[model samples]
Target: MSIAKKLVGQTAAYGLSSIIGRVLNYLLVPVYTKAFLPEAYGVVTYLYSFVALFNVLYTYGMETAFFRFANKPGTDQRELYNKVLSLIGSSSLIFTAILLLASGPIANFIGFPERQEYIVWLAIVLAIDAIATIPFAWLRLQNKAVKFASIKLINIVLTVGANMFFLVFCRQVYNGDYLPELRPWVTSIYNPDFGVGYIFLINLVANALQLPLLWKELSIFRFRLDVDQLKPMLRYAYPLLFMGLAGMVNEVIDRILLEYHLPDNFYPNMSNMAAVGIYGACYKLSIFMSLAIQAFRYAAEPFFFSQANDKNSPQAFAQIMKWFVISCAFIFLFVSAFRDEIASVFIDESYHSGLVVVPILLLANLFLGVYYNLSVWFKLTDRTQFGTWISVGGAVVTIMLNLLLIPVLGYVGSAWATLCCYFAMAAVSYFLGQRYYPIPYPVRSIIGYIVLAVVLLLGVFYVPVQQVWLNYLIGLVVCALFLVIVAARERLLFFNK
Candidate 1:
């Protein structure tokens, strides 16, 4: 098969799980909003933001490291797998213990002293999920996308099921909508006092459910350390640890910072949680873009490492970057054009005010996706520290921007900070990639595509049609025009009919 076809197939398998999994997760937003207040939902968002950071620390770049070493000629795949599993397993346990011991102090520091269980639950969730990372990466390496997708789908289903059981069924029973006989059972299990805590509990339960499926991956008995082998792997992965952490900071710290830095005076009538809730809801509008990026990353990382030795690898990478950019652009235009309709699908009315940032966030994610593609340069060349520098710079951008702007512009400022950080990161990565591992990245054409997308998005925004149907018709026509122009300009690949 052609490399393009293989990439598409692998990406489709990964995307099926990623995109479908996220869409299903997205469908739960309305349920969460209904079951918990904006304040409560905001708390959920806040804790998960911390989870995002902790997840990186817990896994600590082993997944990528595993792929890098495992794909090499001299490395023993079995020994590599055993050492990685043992390393993460020991660290995860240790981390979870420390978190548990310090849960009280940490909860207080984070302004949630009253809800220490949130800390405990997240600690457990992160640990389990962290240790499980390698097995999932193993599935990817093995070309078991079907199994990967199935396991992912199952994990999400169990999570959603657990969420519904708690939020939907138990809530109805508590509200006296259910028959009185079932009350005893439901009431014993359900506590109105739990509130958003149930969300955490359900998540912990869902992550735990994934363990039994990985019996084969985990059954090995290689608990002994190989110091010689471990040294180089650690050296290779350490920079990535920094890179991943900073990257996550770019991704999630806005939600965390919003909770802290939001002015008491901004959103005068609403509490901090309310402001955060609004911002968090609108952020969901960018998930489709994230989903696409994640799917591509899953396939691309292993796929790229495998093809690194091929004579045509550079050209292939360049074409992949072009198509990747085009795909992200289409997503940006689609979401920005229909954002009014799309934003309302699962978000509550209270969150509507913050939806203005949806397009900004989508575009930001596009930049992030591009940066990920450019990052292949560093990863391939084993100059991974460059990634650390770029991401750390982005993280600095994130912190400084949030500190400066969140007070004045509220969550909207946070959104702008995100877009700026990603834009800077993508540009910097591209320049760095050119210097170190130059691939003919079609720079002019990529700029043209991005500019055209922005212009079309502006037209969609300003030239608003009155009828909903008419607006959708306009969006479709604009999408077609963008496609035709792109195809006409670059008929070498996508439009070569």
Candidate 2:
């Protein structure tokens, strides 16, 4: 089978599970916004952004190491799996215990002194998630996409279901006159003061429950550590650990910064927390692009490692990168064209103010996706420190730009910061990747498609179509035309007529 075919097949399986599953999960954005005020929603967004950072810290790049080391010829996969699991499990327990012990001080430090249990609950979920990271990576290594997708979807379903039950059903039971008998029972569990805390609480239950379901992946390993293999794996992954933290900074530091940089007085009657809530909701409008890139990474990472020795792998990577760029460009245009529609529905109208940044964030994520493709070079060559340096560069830019801009332009500044950061990261990664790994990516064709997409996007932005249907029609036609042009240029469409 062609590598393209195999890649598409794997990407489809992963996409179905991750992209579709995440979109389904993303539906909760509306549920959350409807349930919690923007200030409360801001708190949820704030804590979860920290969670993303901490998650990277807890996993410490071990998952990628598992993929690389477990695939080595003559290596015992079972033994490697056991060690990886042991390392993550023990570290997660220690991390969780420490956090739980100091939950109060940490909560107070973060200005959430009253919600000390929030820290404790988050620690529990984080520990479970940290430990589960290895087993999930093990499944991906084994090419168990079906199982992977199933387990991921199950977790999503559980989380979403719990969220709806608590936020919707419980609210109905508590507020409605029909449930007179059940009102007190529902009211007992539902605290208006708890607000968005229930969101995290539901996630905790979901994360905890999903671990037991991953017993197949976890059950094989006893609690024994392999010191020798552990050392090399740590050596390999520690650099990636820094890369992960820096990369996360590039990804989510805006959310974190929006809360701190934009104070209550930043805007008349607009709390920084509310701005964050609005920014977080509007950010969800770009999930179409994020979901695609995430699904691609899920399939691509393992696929890249497996094909490391193939003589044609470089050519294949170039081809894959082209398709990825074109696909991401299509998503960018699709979402940008209907940005208002998605934002309007993604959450309440209160979030509509931040919708203007959707296009910027979408384009930023496109660059980030390209960066992900370029990153394969460092990972494949074990030059993982390059990854760390690149991410740190991006992180520095993210911080500097956010610090300089947020007070002036608000979240829009953060959006521009993200776009600039990813563009710089992609450019740097490509320059270094060519020198180090030297994949023959089709530069001209890729540039042509990108230029075309951006032209269309700019045209649409400047020339607003009053009719919604007309706007969508134009977007679809442009998207179709781009695909046709790509196929004709590559001779996949119209052929030797």
Candidate 3:
């Protein structure tokens, strides 16, 4: 099979799992928004922001390093895997232990003194998740897409089901809404005071469940730390650790910043935390773009490494970049065009005020996807320091803009900062990729499609028609126009090949 076709197949498998699983997971948004006030929901948002940052720390780019070293000629893949898992596993235990000992102080520091258990729960979740990374990456390296997808789907399903059982079934029974006879059983397990804490606890349980599910992969793991093998891998990966941290700052620091930096009463009748909650809820609307990026990343990472030695790799990369841009543009246009309807379906009405950021975030994530595609240059050429620098630059932009803009424009400022950061990162990465390890990406065509999508989306938003049906019809027509144009331009690329 052609490289493009193979990638498409693997990406489709991964996408099926990611997109479907996340959609199910996202259903919790409405449940949470309805169950807890915005102020309460904001706690979930805030804590998870920290989780995203620490997750990068726990894995520390070793997954990619595993991929890099394992693919090297004459390397013992099994021994390399053992060393990588052992390093991460031992460190994860130490990290979790420290967190457990300090959970009380950390809870006090975060203003959650009463909920110190949250820290303990998340620490375990982090460790389990960190340990599981190599196993998951191993599955990818072995091209076990089906198994990977199945495990991922099962995790999501279990998480969603556990959430419903606790938040919906237990709460309803405890409140006497239904199943009054089961109130005794529900009362035994459910504590109303736990509130949003159940979200964290459920996640801990779900992640713990993954250990047994991945036993087949984990069975081969034996604790061994080969310093000779470890030093070079660390050299390649430590930069990625910083890069991933900075990249996460670009992705999630806004939520954290919005919580503290947003001015009092900026949204009228809303606390700063409530505004953060609303922003978090509305951000889910951008998952369409994120889903595409994540699926592509899953399949593209290993594929890129495998193809690095190919003579025609540059052309293959260009083709992948073009299609990736096209796919993301469509997601941006579609989601932004129907932003209101989608928000209403998935987010509660109380959280609808922050929906304005959806389009901005969608566009930002589109640029993020492009940056991911462009980043293959640095990864393949082993110039990972360049990746670190670009990400740090992006993080600086994110931090500065959040500090300067949040006070002035509220969460809207944070949204604008995200867009600016990702665009800058993508532009910088593209230029640097050209100078360092050039991939002949279809630059003009990529930009043209993005511009066209933006224009059409704008037209959908600014149409004079006041009728709902008319607006939707206009959206469909414009979307169809985009598809037609793309099909005409790329006719020979897919079908002929």
lDDT of each: 0.88, 0.88, 0.91
Candidate 2 per-residue C-alpha lDDT over 450-473 given as tens digits, one digit per residue, 9 for 90 to 100? 888889888777776898788778
Between the candidate structures 2 and 3, which one is better when assessed by TM-score? 3
Q: Cα lDDT for residue 117, model 2? A: 89
Candidate 2, after superposition: displacement of residue 156 in Å?
0.6
TM-score of each: 0.96, 0.96, 0.98
Relative to the true structure, candidate 1 reaches a TM of: 0.96
- Residues 1-497 of candidate 1 have per-residue lDDT tens digits of 26756787889999899988888888889788778778888888888888999999998888999999999999878778888888888999999999999999999998889999989989999899988898888888889888889888998998888888888888888889877779889988999888988888888888898888877777763775666778888899999999999999998999888888887868968899877888888899899899999899989899889888877777878878888888899999988898878867788777788888999999999999999889989999999999999999999999999999998889989999999999999999999899999898888878888889999989887895798888899898899999888777777465212
Best by TM-score: 3
**Model 1, residue pairs in steric clash:** none
Q: How many pairs collide in each candidate, listed in order?
A: 0, 0, 0
RMSD to truth, every model: 1.7, 2.1, 1.3
Number of the top candidate by lDDT? 3
What tens-digit string does per-residue lDDT give for candidate 3 at 429-478? Answer: 99999999988888999999999999999899887997999998998999
